[model samples]
Target chain A: MGEKIKVDRVTKTFVVRDSDQKGARKEFTAISNMEFSVKEGEFLTIVGPSGCGKSTLLDLLGGLSTPTKGRILLDGQEIKGPGLDRGTVFQQYALFPWKTARGNIEFGLEAKGIPKREWRAQSDHYLELVGLKSFADRYPHELSGGMKQRVAIARSLAFNPDVLLMDEPFAALDAQTRETLQSELLRIWEKTKKTIIFITHGIDEAVYLGQRVVILSANPGRIKKIVEIPLKHRLADADIRSNPEFVKARHQVWSLLHEDEYAGLYI
Target chain B: MVAISKQVKSAKRLHKLTINPLLALQKLVKQSIVLLLFFVVWEIAPRIGLVDPAFFPAFSEVASAWWNMLLSNELFSHFSASITRSIAGFGLAIAIAIPLGLVIGWYPIARDLLNPILELFRNTAALALLPVFILLLGIGETSKIAIVFFACTWPILLNTIAAVRNVDPLLIKSARSMNISSFSLFYKVILPASIPTMFTGIRMAGTGAILVLIAAEMVGAKEGLGYFITYSQYNFMIPEMYAGILTISILGLIINYGLLALEKRLSRWKQDPTV
Candidate 1:
């Protein structure tokens, strides 16, 4: 596969004002020197502790925010702003509370400027893909955490973007649901063949999900290391967490993350 | 999507209302006990001379006075007059404040520019400005409606601003990532999300609409419930005044619950209907 996305020395900085300090300006760097590219149809997982600018990186890739330093290129075109070419699954689900499961999926299709008459069919197809066909009419408030995340995934995929950027999408789910969703995500990714960049703080999640695990460090976040994982675990035919190769890979990610005390993996 | 939701709606309706009618009615009566008790006390207290009937009439006396006005059709004119003014002022305020609030809430520059003026006007009570409105617009229907409009604006405006501001940032971020157009974002995400909170402001403004209009009418008005009450009071028709007060109370209750039902309908997704 050819390069699908290129983050060429991307850096994000936010200007924040202190409430107590009148007219005082301060600069906070969320992420810096994020130089990486994703190949087409690659399942890349990024692992880092909280506040490591993983979310910032995802925001930049999604075109919700622009990089302070360098530009991001998608299929060799500069990404100036948000576009329908990229779909994102936020950590918070971010499903509109007012919309039903089907309505939420239609949000993407509508943004993509797809015909109104086809929204229902496309939305239902994605809902079934995430195995929530029966809950099509249900709202986010009525859904469980895992169910809501599934709907979020369906929402992003329904838009049919070139790449899907996820920011700790399953971090809030319980152990069993998280594992089940990981397997399901792999299956869906295989079927769709969409390039995915999944961000997480879990060692096992990174090892199990990604073709390559990109480790990041906090406090002026920068790429720490990128570890290539075993192929079988990445393909995920079945529960592979107990596999020796998976454990070894997980340990390597764990050790790499813990080298810096502040960047220790919480999971 | 529409068909699926409709099916769910019917299924839910069927699953609900399984409660026996008798039990539901019994529960309703149980909840009404305190209100019934208060009315009972008012009736007995005046009749027993706990409070002199000359000053505070008995409930039966008030009821008879109310019935007399109802039969003579005197109450209908006043009720209609008061309602028309309240609705006009309230509707105008909603039509203006909601759009203005949405704009100010969403845009930082707009919010900053208008905030000082809003605070200044907000603290100046609507009733306190009645003299100014009368002086400027005169003591006619225009002034009365204007006062209600002024009184109602703050609650609806402030609440709407807060509602727009308090919309979950995550929702907007996600929507923006999908390249949702600015116009679509307003109605699709911001407007619906703001409904529940905005309704709170609107309900408060509903109460303000009545209270402010009545006070304005009492100042100088010919045909309204407020004028009726003050007229009856001046003539020492205590029972008639009480009747007018009762009618106002009922009107307020109806307005409140009506808005509440409308709010519940628009924001149906907010509630867990199954529960």
Candidate 2:
């Protein structure tokens, strides 16, 4: 498979005013010399400790912010700014409070100038895909945390983007709801075959969903290691977590992440 | 099966009790009783000579004066005149303030340039400028309308600026990641998100408009409810004066309710019916 997204020696630095010392500026390196690539149609999960700049890296990939050095390429083209080719799902479930579930999903479609007649069908398809067909009319406030996240996922998917950048999308959900949504996500991924770059701090989640898990360390976050999961069957199948192979793969990711001094701070 | 059937039946009964029409009627009747008692005391106190009749006219006396003015259509003309001036001034304020607020809020440079001037004018009560407005615009409708406009503009303008500036950063980040155009990002995300705050300013401005307009009318005009009250007072027409004062209070109430209804209709999403 061809490389769909490539980060080549990217570095990001932020200049913040020192609150304690007046007129003094401090430079903080969020990430330094980060390099990775996602092949077409690959599910890549990035795991790291808190303050690791995992989110900053995702921001770079999503084209929400530019790197201080190096460049990110999509299909060999340098990414300059945010574009509709990549859709993002936030952990906060940033669905517009003013919009109903279907209206939120149709936001991108409306931005693309899709014919008004086609909006309902396109939104309905993704709502059903996320198992929220009955909740199309509900506002975000009316929906539960899990349901809101599902609507957010469906919203990003409905826009028919080539890449999905999900930032801890299910981290706020309850354990059972998180597991159910993880399987649903895998189902959606299989059906759409869209390349997904998922960010999380959960080792088991990183292993369960990713074909390749990119582990990042804190303190000017850089890739610590990249572990490849060698599951022989679909991850969404029940009892896969009980399989010896799944347990072993999960342990490999956990050990790599735990070796870092900052690992205990997050998980 | 029997337990499941019993649970469903109980749920239906609970829903019925919560939404019962009779319960709603009872609440309304309970509210009206207090108002009726207030009117009863007001009518009896003056009749029984508990207070001087000239100063504390009977409720029936005010009612008959109101009815007489209504029959003569004198009340209608005064009412419509006040309504027209207030509406014109308030509507103009909305048109000017909302756009200015949105622009100033969105652009830091604009905010920096305008904020001091806004603060200065907002702090200076609009009523205090009555003489100056009359001097510049003359004691005509223009001066009255201008003062009302001045009073109504600040709340809306300032609130709009605050609302636009305070939108959640996460919402903006999510919208940006979609690669939506700048215009779409603003109208779709920023505008709707800022609406609740914007409405807050508008409601305040609505009240301000009525208050300022009535005060301005009392000072200069010969038509509005404010003028009617002063005219009746000088003539010692106590009942007519009270009628005019009552009209102002009623007008204020109606304006507040109307704005509230509009706010409620537009912000249906903010309401949590579950609570």
- Docking level for model 2: acceptable
lDDT of 1 by residue, B1-275 (tens): 33335444654664465778999999899999999999899999988889998999888899999999999999999999999999999999999999999999999999999999999999999999999999999988999999999999999999999999999999999999988789998988999999998999999999999999898888899989999999999999999999999999999999999998998899888865557
Q: In candidate 1, what are the lDDT values of residues A34-135, reduced to their tens digit?
A: 898899999999998777898889888888788999999999999989988888998789999889999999888888889999998998899999888988
Model 2 chain A worst lDDT run, 10 consecutive residues: A258-267
Model 1: how far is B199 from its true place, Å? 1.2
Q: What clash pairs does model 1 have?
A: none
Per-residue lDDT value at A142 in model 1? 72
A105 Cα displacement, candidate 1 (Å): 0.8
Per-residue lDDT, model 2, residue B103, is 92
| Chain A (candidate 1) TM-score to true chain A | 0.93
Q: Calculate model 1's interface RMSD in Å.
A: 5.9
| Model 2 lDDT tens row, A163-248 | 99999998998887788788888989999999999999898899899999999988888898998999866654587898888899
